[model samples]
Target: MLSITNEGGSDMKRSFLPLFAAGLSLAVLLSGCGASSGNASQATASAAAYQEMPAATETAVDYSAGFYDAAAPAAENYDMDYGSDAAAGETAAPSGEGAAQQAADTQRKIIRHANMTLETKAFDEALREIESLVTGSGGYIESQSIDGQSLSYRGDYYERSASIMARIPAEKLDEVASQVGTLCNVVSRSESMDDISDTYFDAQARLETLNIQEERLLAILEKAESLEDVITLESALSDVRYEIESITASLRRMDSQVTYSYLNMDLREVLEYQKISDQPPAFSTRLSNAFAEGIDSIVVSLENTLLICASAGPVLVVWLVILGLLVCAILLIVRRVQRRAEQRRAARNASVQNARADQPPAVNIPPKEPEDKVK
Candidate 1:
C-alpha cells in the first residue's frame, strides 16, 4: 500500500510540472504584448507632437511677413479708404506708395557715431567745458581718461591729454559735437551712420514668431501625458525661451544705441595752438617744420633731464662722495707701494757697500808681489 501511494504521488507531480510550464509561457506572452502596446502608444504620441511642430512653425513664419505693417491698414481697409476718398472727391496717395513710404520712414533705425580729435592750450578748461557740455545737452560721459601729473619734479604746465566717450541723444549729437569744436582747436572730425532698419525689423518679426511658438509649446506641454512627451516638450520649450530672451536682449541693446548716439573726443594740452590743414605742406615747409620739431624735442629732453637731476639731488651727492673716497684710497695704496720699493733698493745698495769695505786683500797682495820681485 505505501509503494502504491508513492507511485501515485510521483505521477501527480509529473502532471503538475507541465501545467506550471504552460501557465508561465502564457504570462510571458501577455506581458510582452502589454509592453509592445505601451511602446506603440509612446511612439504615436511622439509622432503627433513632432508632426505638429512644422505646421506651427509655418504658420508663425507666414504671419511674420506682415508683422511690421502696423504703420498701414490691412488690404481690406484700403478699399474702404478709397471709397471714402471717392465720395469726398478728395485725392489720396496711392495705397502701395503711401504705405511703403510711411512704413520705411517710421521703421528706419539709425546708429550714429562721431569722432573728434581736439587740441587745446588749456587742458583743464577744455575738459571742464566738455563735461559741462555733455551734461547740458541731456547726455552723459560714458568714459573718460585724463593723464596724471608727475609726483616728482612737478611742473606748472605739463603735456597732458584726455579721452572722453559721450552718449548724447540722437538729435543732439551734431549740436553737441559742433559746440565742442568751438571750445578747442578741432584737429580731425569724422562721422558715420549705420542703418539697421532691416536687421531690426527682421529680428522683431522673428521674435514675434518665436513668441507664438512658445505659446503653442506651452499649450502642448499642458496636455502631455507620457513622461517622454513631457521631457521632449520641456526641452523644446526651454530652447524657445532661451532664444526669446536672447532676441529680446539684442533688441533692447539696439534700441538704446539708436536712441543715444556715441561721440568720441580726444583732447590734448599744447603750448601753441596750430591750425590743421587737409592738404600736405610744401617740401621746404615740411623740412623747416621737422627741424623745429627736432629742436623742440632736444629742449624738452634737456629740461626733463634737469628736472630729474634736481629731484634726485641728495642721492647724487651721496654717490659723488663715495667715488671721491674710492679715488683717495687708490692714490694712498700706490704711494705706499712706491715707498716700499724705494726702501728695498736702498737696503740692497748698503749691503753691497759694506761688503766692499770688508774686502782689503787685493791691494795688499799687489804690494807683496812687487816686493818679492825686487828681492
Candidate 2:
C-alpha cells in the first residue's frame, strides 16, 4: 500500500508540472499579441494625423482659389469702371468712344467751396430767402448762427447778422450760389474748386492691389503646415484686412464730400440812420445839431469813466489799503529812529554837562580890567 501511494503521488506531481508549463507559455503568447496590437494601433493613429494635415491644407487652398476666381471679375469690373484704357478699347462698341467720353465727363470728382457775404436792408426777409434757396436746391444747412442787437440811442437802431454753412448738391452749386447772390447785396464773393479725380483713381488702384494681396495671403494661410507658419500668415492677413477696411471707409468719405459742395453764407443787416433833408440845413439847425453832438460826446465820456471806475473800484481800494499800510509802517520806523537818535544826543549832551560841572571853575582876573581902565 505504501509503495502504491508513493507512485501515485509521483504521477500527480509530473502532471501538475506539465500543466504549469502550458499555462506559462499561453500567458507569454497573449502578452506578445497584446504588445503587437498596441504598436499597430499607435502607428495607424500617427499616420492618420499626418494624413489629415495634408487634407486640410488642400481644402483650404481649394477654397482660397475659388474665392480668388470669384473676385477676379469684380476687380475687372472696377478697372472697367475706372476707365482702364485696355478695358475701354476691348469693350468699345460702335459708340464706345462716346460712351467712354461720357463716363469720363461724369466721373470727374470735384470738391467745390464758396464763401459770400451779403448785406441786406431787411435781415429776416433775406435770411428766409437764403434758407429757401438752400432747401429748393436740395441742400441742407450744416451750421447756422444769428446775432442781433437793438440799441436805443436818439432812436431805436437794429443790427442783425447771420452766418450759415450749408452743403448743396455739386451739380447745382453754381445755380445755388447765383440765386443766393440775388438775395442781397453781395459784399464779398469767393468760389473755389478742387479736382480729385486722380487721387480717387489712385486710391481705387491701391485698394485693388491690397485686395489682391489679401487673397494671396489667405491662400497661403490655408496651405500653412506648421503652427508657426499659420500664426505668421494669420497676422499678415489681419493687417491686410484692416488696411482694406480703412481704405474703403476713407474712399466712401471722400465720395460723399465730393458729391456735396460747401457754401458759407454771411448775411448782415445794413442800418441807415435818419438823415436831414438833401438841401443844406439852416444855420440854427446846424448849431443845434453841433450842440447835441457835444452833449452826446460828454455823456458818453462820463458813462465810460463810470464804467472804468466801477470795474476797477475793488482793485483800487485794495491797492490804496496796501499803500497806506506801507506808508504807516515807514513813518513809524522813521519816527522811532528819530526819537532814538534824539535820546542818544540828549544823553551825550547831559553826560558832557555833568563832566563840565564836576570840573573846578577857573577864577576871573579882575586886576587886568582895572589896569586897562587906568590906561
Model 1 agreement with the true structure over 47-92: per-residue lDDT tens digits = 2443443344342222223222331121211121333224324332
lDDT of 1: 0.63
State the displacement of the C-alpha of residue 350, model 2, in Å, after optimal TM-score superposition.
35
All candidates' TM-scores?
Answer: 0.60, 0.48
| Residue-level lDDT for 105 in candidate 2 | 51
lDDT of each: 0.63, 0.61
Top TM-score: which candidate number? 1
| Sliding window of 10 residues with minimal summed lDDT for model 1 | 71-80
- State candidate 1's TM-score: 0.60
Error of 1 at 89 (Å): 34
